[model samples]
Target: MCDGYVQCNIVALPEAYAADFARFCALNPKPCPIIGQSNPGETNVPLLGDFDIRTDCPKYQLFVDGSPTAELQDIRDYWQEDWVFFGLGCSFSFEDALLQAGIPLRHIEQDRNVAMYNTNIACQSAGPFSGNMVVSMRPLSVAHTIRSIQICSRFPAVHGAPIHFGNPKDIGIDDINKPDYGDKVEIREGEIPVFWACGVTPQQALRAAKIPCAITHAPGHMLVTDLRNAELATL
Candidate 1:
């Protein structure tokens, strides 16, 4: 809900696995860009904002042994002494750049969550964390797609630019309408679906790691940071 600000994907896990997870993010920067993080047991990520990690995000996902077990508004009860939270750069941060560039996004215009899908593309493996990449799609005309690539390339910290455009099957997405996550939107007559490496890729990695317990921001529910989206632009 905080427009023009940076949004992050939350991934909190035990301190014991923090190094491996950090390495995983480093190896797969596009889908898991590390924006900010908190020390063990600390609920505050000063680098991101003056907010409490436990209660700041609108919704959180609880994962047990790589499987989602519950959804929560607040994670107070599940908080752990040795927990470490990593704030990953989110695609939402770059949408403002796209919008400002005059590139129309179908999902945004329809007031729906962007469609995300699992792809055949594999990420660099780190420890127990390894999985195929996930991507978010936006349908745009050829002109808009090219313009978006130019605009979004300036914001590399938030997934950079389009990874693939045109055929969904080129990236292993069997069906465009049946997304693995989020609502479906119309592709229109003259537009092609453009895909970007999504922050949700970490969740797929989390599931592969199969740590005993983990916490992540639910899809579309991100942590709003005090940082401005403009501040992240390289140009």
Candidate 2:
């Protein structure tokens, strides 16, 4: 609900996997841009804000051996001493730019979480982190879609621009109305579905890697930081 400020996706990994996970983000920056990260056993990332990693986010998803096991409100008791946290730039940051540009977003207008889908696009593997890319879709008019590309391109740290538009089949998305994550919003008659690389991609990579334990922010639930969106914009 905090607008204008930067929003991030959380990925907490054990010390053993931290280096590889960081490499994974560097290799697949479109979906896993790292804005802030903490050292192993550290709860605070001074670059983001004054907050505790264990309790900052509204919700957390617990994964055991790549399978989601539970949803948690707080992770204090579950925190591991050797785990490192990475804050990946989220699509929510660029949504503000679109709204400000006078481009209406379907999911925001419908008051539903943006539609997200798993795509056939393969991510570059780093260590064991390898999987197809996940994307968030926004249905917009052709004119607005072009403008969105220009506006979002300035914020590369927040997924940059639409990776694909028009045909869902081209992206391995068979059904436009049935998304793999988040609620489906109706694509109006004149508008086409535009997809952006999503932060949730890490979760898919985590599943492929089959890490013993991984913690991530639940879909649609993000960590709000004090950094402003404008601070991340390119000239």
TM-score of each: 0.97, 0.97
lDDT of 2: 0.92
The C-alpha lDDT values of all candidates are 0.93, 0.92
Model 1 Cα lDDT, one tens digit per residue, 1-235: 8789999999999999999999999999889989998889999888788999999998999999999999999999998999999999998888899888888787888899999999999999999999999999999999999999999899888999889999999999999999999989888999999999999899999999999999999877899999999999999
- Model 2 pairs whose backbones collide: none
Off by over 4 Å in 1: none
Number of the predicted model whose lDDT against the real structure is largest? 1
lDDT, candidate 2, 106-138, per-residue tens: 889889898999999999999989999999999
For candidate 1, the lDDT comes to 0.93
